[model samples]
Target: MTKITIPLDNPTLDDVARHADVSPATVSRFMNNPSIVSERSKRKIEESIRELSYVPHAAARTLASKKSRMIGVVVPSLDDALFGHFLELFHSHISTEGYTTVVASSGYSSDEEHIQITQMVSHGVDALLLVGLARDESVYSLLNKKKIPYAITWATDDLGEHSCVGFSNHDAAVKITEYLMDLGHRQFAMISGTLKGNDRASNRLQGVRDALARRELSLPDELVIEGPIGIEHGQKAFKLLMSRSPRPTVIVCGADPLAYGAIFESKVLGVEVPQDVSITGFDDTWLAAHLTPSLTTLRTPQQQMSLLSAEYLIAKLKGEDVDVPPTLGVDLVVRESCSSPA
Candidate 1:
């Protein structure tokens, strides 16, 4: 059994052309614009690419065509499966149109996000997909100055002067809270993601507050727990809320992971879900439906948002007259985890 080994140095376009028995110019044309290449040449080049495992130098291609054929995406964190799903959909949609995605995480910091954005731009990303429209003013300015076609995801703020492909976090939260209120839940507590630099988290918190205010209820300082990302943080926050003298009959988590943790912690504390307390979460992730008591959550249109954002950016890159991307909506998924408070 003989093993085929590729050269230590990368295979170049010239090598692919040689293997394909075509001129280097023909090979370049086939790569840059395959539609212009003849069928026979296309087949040959593709076969050569597969046989040699030839990878194009993005930098060289960008220099020749003035198009990087790359899209940059910066999200707050990748720990959430929701973000992973979004990336998967976004990547799949754009890949069909000859674009690749590069992703970076900001750890939920605006400054860090700014740096990542700058780095992506410097590396010659054709466009950017940002999580939200709450970054530093300079970041926006930088995009404008560079004339980069970028879109915001996970939030739809039409008031902002940018293209966005997401739903209103505030409205989704309101829907969840209102539903709980309708279920006769008055004593409410919240386990929220850190709102310091996250507009999504801040908006969600405000949504809960606004809904409570409309019902002549209030979210007391003690009932609100600002938590970091993860199940452990959710567990700790739940414990703190449950420790209150008059424990909340209902707990609203900013995301599903927190709600999952809360449910687990409830069992540990000998509290029955929906009997002693009702719990609700945002982002109807895959796990939400399979929990012991299926979680009541907001079903965000993550796939739709990602697909539209990718398409919008690609269209804009092609000098198309792209309109402001439509704001997708969320659905309220009522499940076993939430019920009338006892």
Candidate 2:
């Protein structure tokens, strides 16, 4: 194949059209309304642009279309695999639709989230994706005042006015707790993520409590360990739980990372999983199935939720009618890590 390189200094739409064997008007249509462009033409235009290394002028595109073609996303943190996987899928889906994504981490702080939202708005993002609905009311008001379309992920509330695409954390947790109860495991200890300003974490903890209450059982204050989400925290929390006079038969972790840490610590302490004490975790991450005992976890529909959230935001930006976002479901993945009380 002959190498073709267009001048980087001044590559124009006409040049792109000539290289792609299409008219200038066709090139403009492909740039602005890619949805209407045929697959053949789309491929040609894309290949030509890549070959020539053509860069579109953002200001010109914005002026012509009256859109920034950018989406802002704010999450608790990107340190964990769960959030990282969701972001990867979400970004991939939106990029195909010609929209760019900008992400910010709140470090699990609502105040920091407010600041990030303000910065994204100042940068002129056309839409936004918030991880959860636990943000302050002022954050919503800010988006409303700016007329920016947005959606919430990680948890769902149909009764709420805001658009959200996620499953019920409370219900999922309840299901897992009931599963443990069915296995004849009575004593329960929970290693939970910090619940402050995090509806997902709080709801999960509540679900466990509700399930335990129905069984005439309660998670004693001494058995509940709430801390930052990390492997080190999980290890320390597991050690504390095991040190109790009457240790729990099974431990439920709020997230997979914590569960992984607990499992590792159990081995380090010469305690066998499911033989010594069973364990469960939420959000079945990639490593969940590969662990020594294979973690029992709830598989949250992160990929589907993220894809739907991106689609909702894009539709709203394009002035299309969008129905109420659907509430996704979670699946209980029974693995080797969980079993009847030893």
The best candidate in terms of TM-score: 2
Task: List per-prediction Cα lDDT, in the order shown.
Answer: 0.88, 0.89
lDDT of 1 at 280: 91
RMSD of each: 3.5, 2.3
Q: How big is the positional error of residue 135 in model 2, measured in Å on the Cα after superposition?
A: 0.7
lDDT of 1 at 123: 91
Angstrom error of the Cα, residue 297, model 2: value is 0.6
Q: Per-residue CA lDDT of candidate 2, range 256-326, in tens?
A: 99999999999889889999899999999999999999999999999898899988988898899997467
Question: Can you tell me which runs of candidate 2 are displaced by over 4 Å?
Answer: 1-8
Runs off by more than 4 Å, candidate 1? 1-30, 33-44
TM-score of predicted model 1? 0.92
Query: Candidate 1 lDDT, tens digit per residue, 215-317?
Result: 8999998898986877998899999888998999999999999999999999999989989999998999999999989999999998889889988998898
